[model samples]
Target: MNILIFFPSIDNGGPTNVVLSLLKGLNKNKNINIHAVYFWGDNDNNLDVINSCCDSIYKLDKVNLKSLYKLLAIIKEIKPDIVHSHCLVPDFFNYILSLCYSYKSVSTLHCNLDEDYINEYGFIKSHSYKFIHKYILMKINNVVSVSKSVLKAIPEVKAKTILNGIEELKTPLYKDNLDVINLLYVGRLIKRKNISFLISCITEINKIRNKKIKLTIVGDGELKSILKIKSGKNISFIDFNDNPFACGVENTFFINPSLSEGMPIAVLEALSLGLPVLLSSIPAHIEINDKMTDGVQLFDFNFESINNAIESMLIDCNNIGYRNKIKSQFQDNFSLNTMSDNYVLEYKLMLEG
Candidate 1:
């Protein structure tokens, strides 16, 4: 079967990585012919990885009226059995294209659109975009959400919860050094991610402990410059690493104090690599934390709560046995093969209908 994966752009985040994981997993099927199109310019490194997974790749100079026509032309030429899109813009565009063509289309919700939009833009603009999105989504074939929280948030539009998955390594990476506890945060430095909150907590921890704890942030965004100024010597920033699972092995713990999330791929990748996690008490994080209790800790989106959670992690950072147990639980539940198989089934079902 021919499948066209449409994305707004290739960026350093969970959504892009999730799409890449799907492409890699689906490519294993001999009958599947995968083609991917990006609405905007590509991230060179991510594009190279995507090129290896897809049979063909197409990129529009930018998302505009001309690009829309070009996208439609490519869709007509490809004549794919299914068109799967990620993010709001791409999903809406695919819905528009579906109106003109007779092909099955599916969209994956990467976050709670309502909250995300309001957090980025103000309430009025967010609500306006929400109305537009709801209108377009109502006409889409199928909607898949990465977390139950996202599906619940969009009750107006029907959606299925399909949690993001990562590949399970044959041998999990084990951190050898236990003297200095390394805490890792892997995602964009956006306001909603609460990167500043994380920095403050780390700063507080350093004040309590004499540089025994270190935070390694592994992503960049708009707040990079401001965050660097706020961060001290205990905290260090690194460019986004596509293979976070490999990086997780070098760290003692993973922490995400984001205000909101939709089954964050970084958290999943970290858990799969046997890194204990300290997450905010968001619905998505709670859903995952409920499954296992030993190596994962959840805190509210406050400085006091974050400071307490970090202290707890520092105390238990030497517990290798607990961390391994978390890895075993993650392996049993979230797997790249299982996620791809479910999407393939969804595509078949949509086509049959």
Candidate 2:
């Protein structure tokens, strides 16, 4: 089976990680041939790994007629049995392209578009994106959402749920009973992330705890300069990294205090590394919390709750073999192996239909 995956871009983000994991997992299947194509976004960290997984890859200049024409040329050459795409532009083009081609189309809904666009572009454009997205969605053959929370943006569409996954990290590292707890946040710095809320919470947590909390935010964003100004010596920052774990995942409590998410891959990556995570009480994070008995905890945006979560994480992290238990659950459920199996089933459904 030949499968072609298209993305508007492949930057350092959750959706891109999902595509990379999908390619790697599906590549292992002897019956399958993978082709990965992207425009405008590049990842120095994962390009080689992505190259290893795909039968072929195309990194076009930008999302334009020229690129689309080039993509169509590749599709004509491969004659892929199914074409999978991510994000808005690729979703629209894949649907339009499928009209002239015989192959089926699949799109993964990576974010709550209504909430995402409202935060990124404001009221008017958010609705515009929503209307356009729903129209394009109706024309696509299959739609997949990373979490049920994301489906709220388009209740009319019967989108299937496929939990996002990542390949396991090489080593699960933990530094025990340290005087300082390393707190980590990774993702694009954007309005919806509300990262300032997180920095404030971490600042308040340090005021009362002897086991001091230090937040290491690993990503570049519009708010980087503003956030750095508000932060203190305890807070550190790294420019956007395709591999955030390179900063060191050891003895860290990964935290995502985002206002919204669609199965955040950074959270999944943290779990794979055996780092207990404290997440905001968003519907998406709650879904992940509900799946497990330990290692994942939900906290409100307030200082008290986040402080309590850190204390709880310290206790949990110190438990003998707790990291191993966390990594084990991640392997059994959220790993790329499981994600590929579920996606392959969806592909079969599309092909058989």
Candidate 3:
């Protein structure tokens, strides 16, 4: 079977990581031929990693009518059995291809489209994009969601929830003899992530407790500079690192106060590395917390709730037994192999139908 995966780029962030993981997983199947096409962004370090997994890779110059025609030409030439898309541009392009071709198409909804649009372009423009997005989603043959929250948000279209997965690290790292509770936030420093709320909570945590906590913010984005200026002495900002599991190992807890998410891969990596999580009560985070009851704690996206969650965590920061249990559960259920198997089954069923 020939499978072509499409994405805007494999530069960075959760969605890119998801596609990369899927590539790594699917490549293990000898019966499948893997091909990938990406349209935008420079060939960063990850491009090499992507190249290693696929039989062939295609990169288009841009996303325009000319580029679309070029992509359609390539699809006609390859005649892949399935075209799986990770984001909007690729999904739209694939949908158009489906209209003129005979290949099965699948799209993974990685975020809440309405929330993403409103955040990026405000209320008025968001409505127009939402309409366009829904139209394309309806046209696509199969839709997969990274989290149930994302699936529920798109009520107009039917989608299956395939929880994102990660490879488990062989040797988990731990911060030994830590004087303070080490907290970590690993993802884009963006408005949807609510980095500002995390900074404020850290500030409050430091002021109220005798055993003061420290937070290391990993990953860079548009809000990085502004967040650095607003952050308290207790917080430290770092650029995006390719290995979040390595960074997470030295921390006591993984915290994400994001306003919205689609089963964040960073949180999964953190849990895989045996770190307990303190997350906001967004539907995605809540869903994770529900599955691993002992391993995660949830709070509202406000100061009061975040402050309370931090205080609760500080009381038992050294719960090694609980952390280990969470890690075991995550390994059994959310491994890369499990996710890849599900996708392969889905691909077969789609083709058979």
On lDDT, the candidate that comes out on top is: 2
Each candidate: what lDDT? 0.82, 0.85, 0.83
lDDT of 1 by residue, 263-345 (tens): 88878877877778999999999988877666688898676786778678767756758767877888666778878988888
Give the candidate number with the greatest TM-score: 2
Cα RMSD, each candidate: 2.6, 1.8, 1.9
Better of 2 and 3 by TM-score: 2
lDDT of candidate model 2 versus the reference: 0.85
Number of clashing pairs, model 3? Answer: 0
At residue 244, give the lDDT of candidate 1.
52
Q: Which is superior by lDDT, 1 or 3? A: 3
Worst 10 residues of 2 by lDDT: 171-180
Ranking by lDDT: 2, 3, 1
**What TM-score against the true fold does each predicted structure earn?**
0.90, 0.94, 0.94
The local distance difference test score of model 1 is 0.82
Candidate 3, 161: how far from true, in Å? 1.1
Query: At residue 294, what lDDT does model 3 achieve?
Result: 67
User: In model 3, what is the error at residue 293, expressed in angstroms?
Assistant: 3.0
